[model samples]
Target: MRKMLQVVAISAALGLLHAGPASAQNRVTYKSAKTETSYYQMGVQIAEAMKAGTKGDIIVTLEESQGSTQNVMEVRARGGDYVFTAPPPLVESAQSGSGPFKDKVDPKFTEIRALFPIPSLTMHFVARGDKGINSMADLAGKTVLLGKGTFGATEGEKYLKLFGLEGKVKLADAELSNAVGALKNGQIDAFVTAGSWPAPNVIEAAASTGVTVISLTDAQVKETGREKLTIPAGTYAGQKAPIQTTSLPVVAYATTAMKDDVAYALTKTFWQQKAAMSSGAAWWNGVDQSLMPAITGKIHPGALRYYKEAGFKLNPSQM
Candidate 1:
């Protein structure tokens, strides 16, 4: 619930000048991903913190969005006050006008600023347990769903290449629900779903039938060049033991136009309220200040000030 705020006068535009600290929009809109995903839930918690922490009267409202890649465009157009993004890698792609974003990404994407590095959201590769598949490479010569809903297809392809199965596997892109249905009917041999702790779809997949969560070995993870995260035992049924897997690093960001004090307050509030948010979603447990963004998106001045004052060391390149 958002606290009722006394309406502070708002202008039609709040063009924050890049020469120095500029005026910010007191009334802010936070754009997140689909309601069912972990990104949306975290967006809600972060928006609430933004609303709760401001010393001056400010309104921070959260809205569901298509995906992080889309949110980058929205933020660029000044369509919202804040936005959540895909892994640091994706953001880097969009910002640098490379990879999936090569021709379509806006040049202004560089103006976006990093608020905080969110915990790595992991995608689990699940297959019908009877398939006898134990790892990503096992899918060689089999049908698989790359899960290109929000995360790009390119990353999925990269994972395949790393496993030395790119040319060996037949891949299809589908929505999560449809992909799950396809798996149940044997239309596909395996599918990937990204989630925090216990990714709900993976649970549904296991409940529907015998399933195996395909994990990557350290060597495979190195080959993929993606961060590895552990899915603890019991996170999903039939997961008798912890498994190591490659994961995505999501980042929270705002425009350079956002004021320093507001950024500082919002960042501080999010960290302080982590425990409370965790009670509702175990995903909150992934929030860590030390896990700096691997991509080159510069930190916002306000957030950087708070981190420095709080004594958190940051990579010099980020400053």
Candidate 2:
């Protein structure tokens, strides 16, 4: 009986030793764009970084999102373990109960806190180069797909109206995921997509079918009131010149429901792994401490703790 008792105790101790790390693991759900989008790819990259950076202490699961608005809406039901990506403007809209969030406003929106900036949402108006579509005006009378429920779609529509192509251009009903395939088949003349450049879909479209990224003129860019961004020459397969466009800054965020320590660890892991992540994905190269000011809303206390420790200066609003 004494020997049997000793064996049982030993087995119990071994089991706990193996289970300790597993029990302490923190699981977080990271919501980004559709699986087919670059944002989703970035989520996968971030998840890998989080797991490795934390030595498996933190596990991140990627959730396919419909749009930024949808990502923000889920905050009402999500707890601290929920992490999402969205533009600063959308978060502001949610906080003020304006724009698409007007009818679905919740106080939980106020709980959203910034973590880190990813990549800016740079606009791409891609059209088949063989179709003689060289400029925004050329989009008139062409069938275009501006993906529904996304910032890209909204911006595309606004540009269509701004450039006087609204009633002239035919809008496709197909999903944006199908846009590249449709364009390659000559079924759609052009498509508007927003992602960090060298966007995968745009790359595929340009490489397979030869696409032209429409550039906005100085006057046109100024009229739109969006910050001007230039997609340098050779960004795509056939592109030979720079394309002027606008961009929306995007950031990672969590709610106040998350523990401070978890947030701090995540923030720290991101900065530490950023250089490594950038090596794999060129889009990550665009992110840096300079863009920290673009992160909207108050920073999560845990994330703030990491930032301060790293000696990053914070604006008053971030506090």
Candidate 3:
């Protein structure tokens, strides 16, 4: 009888142990529409920071999606918890509900909050130095390769249309390497891409084939209404001097549905360990904590909590 009682007690203890609240685990997934190197690097940084800060309580998985349109759609559909996207298209999609989305997103989606602002990506029109393509207007009637499956292409088209070059140039969609190769092979007169300083493909292609990155004039910048940014001298491998051109903004967004506690914890950890991320990749080198803008979309409660604790003004719209 004593042995039986002991056995029963052991069984009850085991059951209680098994029924104890399962360790709370918060897992979030991040998706990037296009596989830009910078986006992927940033995702890696975030994942590492989350893991370190959560002490293994939270796990973050990052993957590549089709692009901004698909990423925003999936996030709205609750298919993803976070995404990296450009501000222009994300804002345009959320506001107009037009284009690739076709009215699928709610205008209130503005609740999607910005985590940080990436450096302005400058548009580069690379051509063979001997090709004699001196300016944006010189691509007329020439077969030009615009970036494929990336924001560069979409934004390029918009700017081209704004500049009234819509029908005058033959646009071909191709990957950066292929576009550069086409230029090397003389199949295309020019290739257009927008990216951070020292764009790897552009630098490598120019080094191998002697290509030139054209600068946009002040008139062109004003006409386009985009911010003009300069690629400082020595940013690229062989560039002799600073290159000035109009730039487009790139930003990362976190879903509102993400738990506020987790977002707050992650944001706090990220800023505290900013050096960890900054030192991990060249792209992160220029990220400034002060430049992280107050996003328009729904801000994560956790982020708001962190901001308030830090004594920063918590704007009503951000909340």
Give the CA lDDT, 0 to 100, for residue 276 in model 1.
Answer: 75
Per-residue error (Å), model 1, residue 105:
7.8
Candidate 2 C-alpha lDDT tens digits along 1-319: 9999999999999999999865698999999998977889999999999999999899999999988888999999999899999999889999999988878889899999999999999999999989998889888899999988777898999999998987999999988999999999989999999889878899999889998999999998998887687888988998889999988889999999999999999999999999999999988877888788887579999999999999998899889
Q: Lowest summed-lDDT stretch of 10 residues in model 3?
A: 289-298
Candidate 3: global Cα-lDDT? Answer: 0.70
Model 2 bad stretches (over 4 Å): 1-23
**On residues 68-186, what C-alpha lDDT tens digit does candidate 3 reach at each position?**
66666665566335645656545666656677656466743655766656655667777777777777787778888886666677777877798778999988756765876788888
Candidate 1 lDDT by residue in tens digits, 181-246? 888899899887666767767777888877999878888878777687887787778889898987
Off by over 4 Å in 1: 1-25, 52-58, 100-108, 148-153, 166-174, 293-295
Cα error, candidate 1, residue 131 (Å): 2.9
Clashing pairs in 1: none
Candidate 2 residue pairs in backbone clash: none
Top candidate on TM-score is: 2
TM-score on alpha carbons, each prediction: 0.79, 0.86, 0.76
